[model samples]
Target: MPLDQIPDEKEMSFLDHLEELRWHIIRSLIAIVVIAIAAFAMKDFVIGTVILGPSRTDFWTYQKLCQLADLIGTPALCIDSLTFELVSRKLSSQFMTHVSVSFVVGLVLGFPYLFWEIWRFIKPGLRPQERKASRGATFSVSVLFMMGVLFGYFMIAPISVRFFSTYQVDPSLQNLFDLSSYINTVTLIIFGCGILFQLPVIVYFLTKAGIVSSALMKAYRKHSIIVILILGAIVTPPDPFSQILIALPLMMLYQFSIVIAKRIEKREARQNKES
Candidate 1:
């Protein structure tokens, strides 16, 4: 090896590849840490307004529902309050929750940058044709991921919080939610839905790799819907409305994935014919 010479990717050893990946991971961590510090600094706003919003009756989602309730003459649709008492049993619980929530906020906000770094590492390993097929992948994946996060935040979190907070098996029963558990549940739901929204991107690559096709997806449409509904039930409160809310978007995503697979199939067919 020549001194001060850059080695070709193909010439790089496994350790060299690992070193490059380590740097990418470090940079991604730095981005998340930076965001986390900022979130930690804004403790009141991040915790009170963002994390606790869904747990309050005055959240934007609840306000919108109240308006819809008025318009539809359905007073029951208006969520006036959350009946649960959120308590921190441990003396350090609040402080620990703040730190953990800050990190989660960082992860959510820094997701695009983190994924971009991973993509950079992976892109060089992909074939040129594969690279071309996945152009704008970073942007598409980031957008879809954020959309899912937002949808889960606005659509699922509030409803689930309200339902669980208010639901009672007996009049003597009380709902006392742990502060950390409540916040963690909200963050987990958002992150889970964000990951789920990568279905289209996953399908596109799978289609290109010939492991999946539009025909298979279309054939399994009913099965997919059943699975999505089950997922919605699992992630959301066991209410039909909450389940429907999550299921509707996931169903749409599955349909969109089918379209994406079909397009890939068509493009490959055309290329084969031309060649």
Candidate 2:
């Protein structure tokens, strides 16, 4: 789409776009702040229950692992216990932790609305066909992001917490974890996975824009596997089981992205032939 053909006038200066972006940022921030206030109000439930759920060995993940161990005849899968002491060293640590954690929780919950606001800002610049072509973008992005967030919180976060809490250099060294550190790790994993899981949606757009194709993705399958494994290793613990667990889902997402790209290509081709 050319500048003159866009809904916004071609005569509008770059400063005009900047001004529009400022409003978008303001709206996004307001939404986050409102949600943060709600999160803070639900202090006990959000902090004591949801945020710290994985800290206990009786979390659903541990129970599932135990059940899997029984079924597979692998005692190693049964997590009996995790040892770690959560502590606050500084006076302001707890207060800061509460505020920051609430903010992060707010952001996670408000992600869809945030993205919607972004879409609203960008949609004005898009041609009618372009907007139509990207229909359901917000819904698909939200669902994928939330799914990834849940996976990280329920699966990856618990596994990481269990592994790190149980790891020890020596019998004499006590495992004392800082509250801030723990929350940071959990938040990073949740948000990271959420962003990474947009692979399929990203591929759709990239293919539509003619930046990449399904054929390219198919040709690089082996290389993609190596990259996926490397990504898994970067995100997960050094253990092969953990790496493979992360890699498998990533590879599946890659394959799914290829399919999405191919569908987009075929659809575009059909539309062009009709035209």
Candidate 3:
């Protein structure tokens, strides 16, 4: 439908808007389910390699850590082995893992399409100027999500797994992890990082909406660093090395977000002056 033909907020009845929204949501769900079926079909590769890759010493994260340690002369950065065994104690645990993993895969694979569906729904409600302003949002969001997912898988998740696997209260103690717990760790890492990586995009939108500004971000810079460091400590190992590892990248992202906000502010100022 053309912009003039599209129903305005007051012109459309609530139920009419709801009906349109329902279709959009249904289409998005269908896309995810289809992708999930494909993921289920590739169960062997997904479970054996993609899901379990972080538990192996030869994983990319370990190799990178080893190289960094060698360069810096840090012996503790070594990851010799993943000491824990992942076991399913309940009869239904394995089946649950399969379902959970498939759903996660679906979400990751279908995210861009899902967002596009969302954009389609909202575009009709936006002004031409607003739509034009958001032209690059979809691409940027997709790229950021993928980068975050890879970072979680290859950097944050491995360090976390290695740290927990080797952590012991006593010499007699051994770590035998549950399948559900392991899946939770991996999926949570991927999704959490993916969402966190949207900081710059979020700032851009908030700036567009006039809810936040670059000067505000600048004022909170110190607090943001403290919060980032705290989050890094929570997610990564107890060691300062791992905490710093996570915090540094996040700090860089925060700085980037500030820069984006500054540009948006400058653009808005220019438009205001022109008017």
Candidate 4:
């Protein structure tokens, strides 16, 4: 519907607005549930191929790491084996895990459509300029989310699995990981990264709201680096190399957020001058 056809927020009561929001949320949930059901139908493939891929030495990430090690003359980076086996202790553990994983997959896959519904609900409340300013918000958010997911899967997840699976307190002790524990680690890492990758979008909104400014971000550059380093250490393996790897991209994102903030400031300044 066009902006002119849509009823203004002033025309609707609080209950009417709430009802509209409820329907949007309901639609989003329905999309997620439908996708989840479809994912559940392919539980075997999702669990075997995608979920367990990082634990295997023959996985793409491992292979690439090994190749990089060969080029650098460091065989230590070549992960030849993972020293853990995943086990289910309870009878219904596998079935429950399957359902949970399917739901998570559904949420990830249906995120774009879900956000589109949210945007539709919010669009009518925004002025024409605000709507125009956020023209590509949904697309940008979705792309960043997927990029983060892929980064976690290909870079962070494999390295973390390899490290945790191989690290041992005693040579005689064997690593026997629970199935739920493994899945939780993978999902958390992927989703965490996805959230982190929305830095630019978050900054845009904050800047537009006059809560955050480019000057503030620039002034806090050193402190931000420290925070990013801490975050990298928290997310990745407890090693300098792994921490550095995660920190680099995060720092880049911070810098990119600053640039985004600057653009928003300039745009708003121009609009103010015109008015």
Q: Itemize residue pairs with steric clashes in candidate 2.
A: none
- Which number leads on TM-score? 1
Could you give the C-alpha RMSD of every candidate to the true structure, in order shown? 2.6, 3.2, 2.5, 2.2
Error of 3 at 16 (Å): 1.5
* Residue pairs of candidate 3 with colliding backbone atoms: none
Candidate 1 lDDT for residue 206: 93
Cα lDDT tens digits for candidate 1, 95-182: 9999999999999999999999899888777777988998999999999999999999998899889878878899899999999889
**lDDT tens digits, residue span 186-239, model 3:** 788788778778888888889899898889999999999999888876665566
As a whole number from 0 to 100, the lDDT of residue 116 in candidate 1 is: 92
Q: Backbone clash tally for model 4?
A: 0
Clashing pairs in 4: none
TM-score of model 1 vs. true structure: 0.94
Write model 4 residue lDDT over 1-275, tens digit each, in one string. 32335656448768777888888888899999999999999877898999999988889999988999999999998998898999999899999999999999999999999998888888888878788888899999999999988998898888888878878989999999999989988898787787778889999889988899999999999999999888877766676766677778888999999999998898888989999
In angstroms, the error of model 2 at 180 is 1.2
Number of the top lDDT candidate: 1
Itemize residue pairs with steric clashes in candidate 1. Answer: none
- Candidate 2 residue spans exceeding 4 A from truth: 1-13, 237-239
Instruction: Please tell me which model should have the higher lDDT, number 1 or number 4.
Output: 1
